[model samples]
Target: MTREKSQSIASQKLQQKVKGPVAQELKEMVPNRKSHQREPRSKDAASNSPVQASVQSIITQIQNGKPNVSGSKETPEDLSFVMSSIFPKETGSVDTSNLKMKPLDYERPDVPRLSFGLERVLFNPGVYHLRDPRSRVYNFDPYLGAIMPVSEFDFDALKAYITSSKDETLAGIARAEKKKYIGSSSSMTSVLSHFHYLLSNWRGVDTRMMSQNFPDHMRSFTRLLRSPAAMFLRYQNGSYAIDADKEFDSANILMNLGKSMEKLLTLPKEDFERYRRTHENKISAEEEQAIPEAYHYSTMGDFLMRSQLDAYDPRLPGTGMFDLKTRAVVSIRMDARNFEHGLGYEIRHVQGGYESYEREYYDMIRAAFLKYSLQVRIGRMDGIFVAFHNIERIFGFQYVSLPEMDQALHGQTDTSLGDAEFRLSIGLWNKILDKVTAKFPKRSIRLHFETRDAQTPFMYIFAEPVTNDEIEYIQTKNQAEIDAYQRRILNLEPKDGNDDLDETPASPEKPAANSQPTAEQNAQPDAQAAYDSSAPPDESFLAELEAEEADLFKGKEIMAMTLVVKNLVNGSPVDRPMVFRADDKWTVEYELSELQGKQVSRLYNACQTRREKALSGRGEDEADAASNVYIRRLRDLAMKGRAYRAKQDDFDSKHGTVVLDEDV
Candidate 1:
């Protein structure tokens, strides 16, 4: 038989095998199909229908190197093109065992908990839907395409297959006629050349160095190359070198951004600071004190900006903790700030800017987290955990202290954390301090708190002790407060010792709602018995527990603290020994001075919007309910220890909700 005849026969057999949507689509595309009547044929279309002619024409064009049909010359996509992608020649023999038709093992919890904490589910594992490769439903980046498996159960085998496929692609490129590649603006070729150049040099050049020193054509070649041999470039011996054995992939690329993408993604800390120092010329004593150093610096991604890649920072903030079982990075950010304080780490907003509560930010953070998690799960990375760390020292100073806060705080008086008289001032302070320490129990969470003056920089390290004197002072203070507070709480409730502190009783008859136990409490050694007053307390045991609280005060006084009293001009840490009393009121004092007017106006407008909506009978909606709750929380906080909202409303109406110029 002729080769063309055999080819036609094979095509017919393939068509028979290709069932479902593609076949249905092909049948639909056929013209003039009837139960009893035959379709009319054209003169040139000897043995073929219009659909067959069109398909044949497209396939011939494709074979003749005209894959991309121009506008004027374009035709409806051939049926076979769609079938070719979905039921590719190699995958024509479907392996039912390997095909993932159900939820994956990772998707199913081994022993599912009733509720996985927000962070645990923050970036829930991406759902692995069995899909035809041609389907546009999956957001397939080149790197993900190179690593993600079609079947979750055969992940290892699939990854190997993908790697091999990439190798074959590279091999094909290598064997292609070099003469045809002259002046070619091929991203794949550009990436390959750079990779080869880097390997030949043996000494790694960062993305920045690559751009600056090499031809401008190679600016963003690193991101495009989804090669298995990509390395984590770091300092080895004395000079920068790629970890050749290290098979860096997408997640690893993000994880090692500090080392690899530093040239492009970040400016050195000293350089950034020097720029700030020079540009500002001189700063106020308050602004000068918050000069940022020893904190992560934000840099404008030159590649991102130039390439117009205005998206999430590919490199995520570390989780600060890793899974011991798998060494996978496991971290969660508790963004109660958005819901509670209306402040947040906005992902879509420019870096080093105020994070507000918006769906964009929420979606950005979650999507990045989920993508990273998926990468790690597929074994493309060593480990990654994108947990929350209140990195105020890094991003905050730039936003607030760059003459902006000075402008905002200008003419403002008595900027202190102890200003309990300010609306929600005290409550806000407690919430921040509480949330920071409470985020990760036993794990160290570094928190920096500054007054408006920015003079007294307060640093707290969770679960670590600072000075004995400081610890002793706080322990004594808290014990006394706990006694008084408990007595007051107990007095308010009936004689049933089970009355809770965090919640109000549902009814007068039922036992009062108990305060929720903190993460630290849940992790405490003998926590239940030690905290329980129903059982007679052992003196020695109580002493030991008291000692534990001194070092690890859950939500009371900060565990490890450093108070800087120096008149420093830069945002560097100053180690000063100072005492913090639990009784002394601490208020939430951020450099909202720059944003005071704007935020105040915005917030008031938001409140008015909620009020308007409520009046219009739209308050029953979820959004209105949330807005009402946010407004009420802010209102309640602002009015704490004050006479009423009337006194503050006038001031709030003018300055803002957060700006308090009054004396304590």
Candidate 2:
């Protein structure tokens, strides 16, 4: 048999022999490593025991596809459990008296701080408000159709409610995963925002956790060395760039599941924006209202920080805000995406479930707390409520305060505030970032981050060149600035110095009504609108998907299509290309009411031409997005883009194109 086939079979047998949550970590590994090369073994490298040798034997068999294997049916008990499981899970509330203590008050190095009384420095604002500089990126209203008061937090009730809808939620997530939720998918709305965490982790890697925080400052890289090494990346667009390698993201699944749980666990109090929406949108006020947006923004130096609160619990003292988290019982392995029948992918009861039967305290400390702590502190929230589940059932829920999380990660030798160590890490990370940027400003670069089991403290970072895009991936305050840089660097005039779609302005028409329209009517703009990145897709066009795309989509259930259309205009245009369902066809909303009919006809003709061109230009490889499934999201987007182009063309045609500071 081939080496790859042998490796797959051997790995499968080994995982099958393991039970409980021990196999969870085995599912996700660092990419491109011979093993967990990203985290080198500093402590156990010199020691060799039977357990180590036996595990090595298994690895060797898998790697070389040897004739005999440790995990073969003849030697089933060759290895009892992965060594990490020695701690075992004795579930229930964990005792924390042994953990070190420190006061919660500390100033955030990034945000402005306020001091109260003698030493209490509140780094996170009691209330959050800051200018958001991103466009194309969209905001969404929170879902409040089933929020309950914080005082009424009944684990049993939550378990009952969530468990009932578990199947539907998992199924929805499965379908979403299958579709890979591209283009205008709600998952894409705050896409850049999600990268901050991973970025911080990359920056914060040092020896306080291993001294002045250098590679050789003091000692142990043990903790970081023990971390899962599967995360790898390539940077782009002034932020952590997206990669196709991250096709099946468990983190996203957790985020979605967590959001659903938050809606269920939250208090029904209407947020300020939702109250405003009720007053403004007459239809929304008269009908079921769209929930207000739920997120807080703050700036730390030149970087942007956004904290998405899961829920606000007044019942909790102080900040009262708390995050809801879903800890999956186990990660679904690549070989078996059988989410439906998988042993660990289902939901359970709050009382006697998988959690009760397993030990999670050490697991929480070693595996989850740092990230959980970072998130809690980012919002300066009171704490987090965690739901442990095996997907088939609900195990239970537990709350860990910021202080508790701090103690677990930092321990009792209090430095300056409980967050002193973290602050230092941030400073050092920034320094490293500054050096890198200084060396390669305004250029696209590849960062090869990985661990090497071949050496001690296996972390390695390789900086190399990549074919540059128009815009740099360095830090910027907002999307507009990023756009500005692109405009300055890129020539609008085509290679032959001729304008293909020369930008111009059409004759001015009467202004659109100042009154707001329904969410469906004007998805993104009050004047020239486009589809909100977060707007519910116009899936009424799904029938066209089956007809125009592929036979595989024939008779399949209606699902979200994965097509993305970029913003076509760059200057003084507030009415972006928002996609909306207008009668039988999707149209961009024209904020200028008097011009809607003419605008619609022009865009319709433009879109038709673009669609024909896009269809004719398709290639075999780029055609199927989901399995053998094909979609017109690309063609539809091209049509939408052409419609946008027509808008720009009308303008340039009426008023000859001019290049000015703001004329992009």
Candidate 3:
């Protein structure tokens, strides 16, 4: 096929795929139904009908060579794209067997006594009462029999009752059992089926009763059996209540109750036995003696259990004690702001306005402790133990220094103490200390001071023994402050010296202030005396120097001087043999020479005149031109003398220079 035809066929196939079987079905279903319907359709229905029409139009456009009717430009589907679209690997399948299968080797143990004192009082009150009634007086009601012992008794009987009522409970049990297996299914269909079965079969009363009555031994097992099914059902239906009107089947409930008892059963029997042994003798003695008005009964089992969980040491090997944290509200306050007094007034106002019941409780306890101890070492003492009853979350006890605690307690809201932030702060402190040490290498006895957050009642304070480097840095900072202050002072000071000079008097009587003496008076005294004592020359010396200067320019021509030189040399000449005077240094005169030597004499005279004028600060340009002309005449004579010799050398020696050979 031709390329165009091939492309067209591919486009047709793409249009068919993009249109999709679902879309075609929707179109076919709607078109005939719409024709038969005489009733007016809602806006939503009417709007949906055109969407299929638009898809069809786009399909037609793709089939023909036309603009896409559907606004979107759809690409043709290749085989790889089709495979990926149909069979997405990431979320396509899940191995549910691993998720649903219970751990095979974990056997349910017989329930033991509840070990925690508080938990026993709340969850197993019957055990607490049976063990010691006198310790259970607060808010007590005799009619509402203790829940633990009663539940335990009923739990055993309920199981027996369930085994006997097999026919009545079969449907519920079968459904529950099927739910358990179905919970293991990987397909969405199986999961949905299991969920529906759970909703139809699950009995809330049975579940709740089992949970209430379940001993510690059975708790894990009960949760293991029932939790997944309940969760799956709740997720599907979006609610906990199913079959609200019907009573829960007792058989399945008893089975769940039996399962929950597993946790209590798993507790070490030796621990309970030890408690029983330790307390039996004491109880008997108390009974034999006159009964006291009040008594406190404690158990070794409870004590050991608590100590096992709560005891932690920083030095403990492999404990990872520092990493463990109990979730608790941590209050942080800026003690530095407090120390600054009114400087941070806005922050202070905020701190004053904010209050929490927890803070109040903590404060009360702290005050009571202080009152009892006189001086409490807060850092050494474990702060508090907070327990989350509804959840398994636990918090550890910690205490911070007084100042740190004060800072934390005064200013801010509660925030979690992040391990990362604490570690970062420590690292920063170490780096700062290192830098300080490096800066002051010579200082052996250095003390460093730093500020850090206190954990308990979170606060900040000056931590001490600062290094020499730290002190020097602070000193440098202070010096900068001082320099700035000095500069400001300097700028503010008046410009006294210059201003005073401007205001001074300028009288002639003040020796013509700022003016220099005339040249004759300022001349050296010795030179001046010599000049005064000696009589002036009879003009002969001056005439001789002038004649000598003229002889120097005798051969020079006047017209040879270019217009540039004329303008630069003499603008106008005086017709005179110009005489120049010098003080004991020299003298010169240039006059007309004999008439036969007029040209040479005139040129020489002109040159000398120009020279003398220049020396006496006249005709500067003329003097420069005369000097240049003299130098050029000398250069020309030298060049002419060398030309013949140069030519001879070039011809004979094959070199540039030629020397003239005189008649030797």
Candidate 4:
């Protein structure tokens, strides 16, 4: 027997054994879980336990691929009763089973995807205006649409709803397991992992009775994980919401957006000329700042209303990510260049400890957040996504030491307004860290930061700095690898030694109305436009021109029908030559070697005689005839190019050599 076959059989036997005794114990524990909570144990203490051993066996089985995961087996429909039986009142008013569920979909090109970091301004204004319409209690009413003002948004109420929904989802899974949701064809190890994750963290979710129904349990568990309830529990925290004054209202945000849009649409020809005359530079300072904000708001509004969800069903909701707890789509950005923005200037680390200093930009950060929060309040934005570029490379993953945080919190400072504001921001951040540590006591802050790093350039920041051990694999790469990573992340090309950086233009998200290209035109590259590194090169790109030329000559047959047309008219004023034009039909019908030797000599002699006669003081009738023949030959050459393109496209598609567009 093959080694793989032997391993598969062994895994099957082990799984069968787990169903015998341990399964019964797991099933019995669920009914009595309310009496007590399991005491936390160190990894060492639990390493040798039977449950752990069983889990290990299940992992092995998955690795062997004895069980399949794609097919689904029906499980119990009502798991909510399990949780409802324990916490009846906490389950809230929302019907967990009826709260329509959908699969998670993240890919959407039109929806602004930003990373968490400094230059967040690129998308922050739009994020500050995002409000979820599916949410029942937050800004949405399910039927009525956005109904509540930002001030009316209650975090506690939102959390309660998701919590209740989660309990019901877990209950459904438990019931499904009891009824045997795991299909006979399902891969045992793959299905078991879902239960293992829940069992490790949550007690009373024993599915041992349904050990035979591993498939069913896995499907239910996956559904629960994709639900809004799971997303809220995983991402929402102290840093999820911006702290702003009670009187602040984000409603003005919409007004600001409207004004910005109006300014863009209302520009006149005379105003353009006046502005141009007033400033010799292409754009004035005010216009530079105003244009992006206008684009941001306009793009945000359109996405909210029409963006499609990342799912099979197109009608549910747009793919704008929402924090169920806060009801906002967090906009993100990464600014690796500098930490000059925001309230970062107040505290600086020197000599392994943080030192306090006052800088002109201290209030700059505070005022920015205040304004941002005000917009968040009005727009109902939930979280801020940011990435500190070069942070991990410069300071390592664990840059913010606990001592530094403490120092920033209590260090002495001048009595200036900026310094005072900085202190307040620091104190709030400290409290946020405390909440994060308490909420996820077992998780390492460093790991969380690393995982977030992996999601950089498009990561959303909850109101706090939370770290987990799950670092993206890319984070481990060295400087050279990082260069490749940056290129991929930004969809940029590697800089060759001879690259000229000066000619590159900034890539604008949206072109002006007059500058907008049609879909057909945009789909094909223009031979006339200058090269744009941000965009894919035109079809006849210079880089590939040589290769195309080589391919044209690759075949043994180089020429088809060699036709030499000579002008037989007398001399004319124009100086012209007998040209060679290869038609598509000629290339298809004849070989290059077939048209060589005698054929070329005969064609060349006829062409010279005709050319001399056509150029001599000729009759108008003869000259016109010669001119028509030249134009017809030129048309035939153009047809050859078109035919080549058509053939190339067919071959690429048939051979699966086409490049797919990524959702950038």
After TM-score superposition, the amount by which residue 433's alpha carbon in candidate 1 deviates from its true location, in angstroms, is 54
Off by over 4 Å in 4: 1-5, 12-237, 241-281, 290-664
TM-score ranking, best first: 2, 4, 1, 3
* Candidate number that wins on TM-score, 2 or 3: 2
- How do the residues 1-664 of candidate 3 rate in per-residue lDDT, one tens digit apiece? 7645654564444434434543443334332222455444554443342223233333333334342121012111211122112211111111111111111221222212222322222222111221122332322222121112212222211122121112223223323333211111111111122121111122111112122322222111111111111111111111110110011011111222223232222224342222232333322323323321111111110010000112223332232111111111111111111111111111001011112223222332222211111111101222222221001111111222222232232111111111111122222222332333333332321221111000000001111222334323322422433333333222334444433211212212322222222222233443232222223223464345346534533443211110000000022221111121111111111110011222333222322222222222211112232245533343343344346435533764563222122121
Please provide TM-scores, in order, for all candidate models, with all chains considered together. 0.18, 0.33, 0.15, 0.19
Give the lDDT of residue 152 in candidate 1: 13
| Model 1 lDDT tens row, 1-664 | 8555544444554456457654543443333222535455554442222223333443443323332221112111222322332321111111112221111111211211111111232233321211112332322111111211111111111111122112332223223321111111111121222212221111122222111222222211121121111111121122111111111000111122121111111333333232222334423445424432111101111000000011122232331211111111111121121222322222212211122112212222222222222222222122332222121101100101111111111112222211111112212323333333343332322222211011122111122212323322322422433443334422433445653332321211321123112223233445333322223337576456445544433433322211111111122211211122224332122211111111122122222222222222211112333346544543344334134324534754686422112232
* Candidate maximizing TM-score: 2
Each candidate: what lDDT? 0.24, 0.30, 0.22, 0.22
Off by over 4 Å in 2: 1-256, 267-290, 299-302, 314-318, 330-336, 342-358, 392-395, 413-418, 446-459, 464-664
- Leading candidate by lDDT: 2
Model 2 TM-score relative to the real fold: 0.33
Question: For residues 116-180, what per-residue lDDT tens digits would candidate 2 score against the true structure?
Answer: 11011123322111111122111111122122221122221222221101223323432433321
> What is the clash tally of candidate 1?
18
lDDT of 4 by residue, 139-224 (tens): 21111111222122221111111121123332343243331111110111121222212111111121232223223232122211
